[model samples]
Target: MTLLSIAGGIVDDSALSSMASNASTRKTFIDSSITIGGPYNFHGLDLDWEFSSTTTDMSNLVFRSLSYPAEAMENNLDWITVMAFDIGAPTWKPNLTEAPAALYNPFSEVSGDSEISSWIRAGFPARKIVFGLPYYGYAWKLKDANNHGFLAPANGADITADGALGYTHIRNRIIGQGGAITAFNYTFASDYCYNGTTWVGYDDVKSILAKILYAKGKGLLGYFTWRVGLDDNWTLSKTV
Candidate 1:
């Protein structure tokens, strides 16, 4: 099905707020969208309203009152896609290295598993949830070559992709370059490799399969990747 994705910038929040607050405006906006998309044969629309700070803004968007918010989601939508990646990165916290999309974090509740559990507790059904995997990773410049591991001391974000690297680039420039030691952590369900002072954390075939198994075991509907083009020769996509 063709889905029209509507991405709004920070400046558009006020317009969304205005539309949500007024039923007439909301209908006009949605009707106009449908009219425009009819010729394109679009099946659905996806709204990516980046931020909704207030509860009222959220309630307005869902056409529900604060008391019955979960009910609104259950009735108004087919399923929810959870972005289980981008949990941490050197750009956000440069003191130490981190997993960009860790499945489990033993030390804390900041993980994909934890986030899924939170959604379940928030009244979203497991069968209606879809897990997300990343086809990209972050690169960190290690302070010491020997200290290349999760939470290891790091100089800062590496030069590649401004601390981010697609799977294709990671596989080609680093892993394919030879001598890059690749390691997978079963505990976190993540993959990382280091070549001298350059350390890259990303998901590989093993990690991707592990996450798929986890999603299946959890009774999730399915899984999706952030972008298909970033895959290393469709390796990650084929695995899923």
Candidate 2:
């Protein structure tokens, strides 16, 4: 009933301890879907994965999580969510526009998923493995900008606000705004509106649904989001 969500940004042990201290009353949960690097201390609460790099092998990440099972037990945390969004679109980067050629479809990578599952089987119970699904897609600048070198733009072609609308909201807003929707073979899904200057990039309902179904097929415990606020009309919860 109570889920602790962990994410990126600086978190200290005192904060986690406070949550664990009042665990019975607060029902605090850690969402670790976007954690990058940490064994961060939150009242002894184990750090969870945040947005990881494409280069991070899934097997290694699961091993890292398994390494802290004792600490998790001490903190009364029996569940661990295996952040798996990066597995879908390997090239997807929030701040970057163009994806590197090295990035490939994560679904096709057997070693990664197997390693993650193996780690879970060895370390935590099956019910503790919550998989992550993304509600947004990466957008790349067709042209170079600021010489950032493969850094993609943040607010591409989606509606509502730059990086504000969720996948569902983007679809609805596009339909409402009378914009054309198109799916690209390389990108999977996209929406564009002519603002008289440039085109943007974003994911559509099809892409989000694909991820959801994929998570279900993978026998994951549940699906989680990066942030509920980024969802349009609070659709993330509804989707879950």
Candidate 3:
């Protein structure tokens, strides 16, 4: 089956009509295994932890959208993708053993996934909610003597096409240069590499697979990613 999670921005009238036309024109495309999905960004929400907050809202919104008439939500779309991440450093201290605390403390003491699962169960069709498994992790600078800390972007550091390094461009450089990657067991699934000076953290196949299993156990539809191309090695897809 070929599940197609339509990005959320395609919900407009013109876009919907365009999609319907495309669906009719493509004879080679099998309708089976096809599902439409929505987009939710962790960085775009109001919750203490963007990841958990966005998932909660996304699950609810998708359920409502799916229940709407075909004119609003294409009938061919059968699922929605909720973006989830594996980093807790920005919102809480990186605790290898204990779950990180939420910044907003909604449902005090709730773990990230627990909050997300609860929201998903509240309204979304459990079988039609696809969780997003990230292929990267955030790198945070350990607190220094100056008491300052730094965070790595969840999307990996941004990189120039020419491969110049910026605050956000270093991680990609290391990965592209064939640096040795290392995995560390923490409350959040995290992996890191060293450039002989700075430490970089991100996600990999094992971490992504763990998220897929978590979604499956929650009776979710399946998994999705922001984009499939970043994982050039296909390790993430193989795990799925």
Candidate 4:
């Protein structure tokens, strides 16, 4: 089933309007989502809810609006790809432009309250919400190399491409160049590198496999990567 993925991905008021209870909520989402193949023609929809840590998200708005039409239009959406990354340090710093944090750990303080959880709490089907794992990691300059705790203070950004180091870059460039690439507290299900000044926390084959195993145990819908080009060859993908 070739599903069309909606970009500018946020369940905004316009999208919520699809659930306005007045009329055409399904048509709105379907119209905006599928143009190449009319509503009934396409296989399904893939809700790409990105940048969604708004503290307020919904499913009733979409479920109530899309439920009936979903069946009629045969739009039993392929699955939802939740952007479950970018978890900053434990403490929120207003001035810090960037910080070090696990790119895909679900156990974080805010991970539970974000995309997947919010949607499910709002009543979206768990079996249809495929989890998202970042193929990249965020970098930050450590302020106190001595006290590198979960929420340790950071000097500034890590100054990498987009302030994020991809699996390819991390594996080929960072790992052996400065320091050994190693896993953090094993139980944490993440990896990191501290080459004196730069501290990078990202996912490697071990961590990604662990996450995939964890997802399988939970009966998650499936897995999806942020981008195919980010991984080193097929290291992460094949491992997962």
Question: Which candidate number would show the highest lDDT if scored against the true structure?
Answer: 1
Candidate 2 on 1-240: residue-level lDDT in tens?
433345353455444444444435234342332232234433334455443332222223332342444334424555555544333221334344432111123434432245456656555555556655455543333333333222334434222333333455444554456644344333332223222222334434444455556557766566566655566675555655
Off by over 4 Å in 1: 8-21, 63-68
lDDT of 3 at 178: 69
**Regions of model 2 farther than 4 Å from truth:** 4-7, 10-77, 86-125, 144-169, 172-176, 184-203, 234-237
Regions of candidate 4 where Cα sits further than 4 Å from its true position: 9-29, 38-42, 49-78, 89-108, 112-125
Error of 4 at 134 (Å): 0.7
| lDDT (Cα atoms) of all candidates against the true structure | 0.85, 0.42, 0.42, 0.59
The 10-residue segment with the lowest total lDDT in model 4: 94-103
Clash count, candidate 4: 1
Q: Candidate 4: lDDT over CA atoms?
A: 0.59
Task: Highest TM-score: give the candidate number.
Answer: 1
User: On residues 4-44, what C-alpha lDDT tens digit does candidate 1 reach at each position?
Assistant: 76754335788778887878998998998898888899987
Give lDDT: candidate 3, residue 54: 33
Q: Model 3, which residues run further than 4 Å from truth?
A: 1-77, 86-112, 137-181
Residue 36, model 3: Cα distance from true site in angstroms: 15
Worst 10 residues of 3 by lDDT: 95-104
Instruction: List the candidate numbers ranked by TM-score, top first.
Output: 1, 4, 3, 2
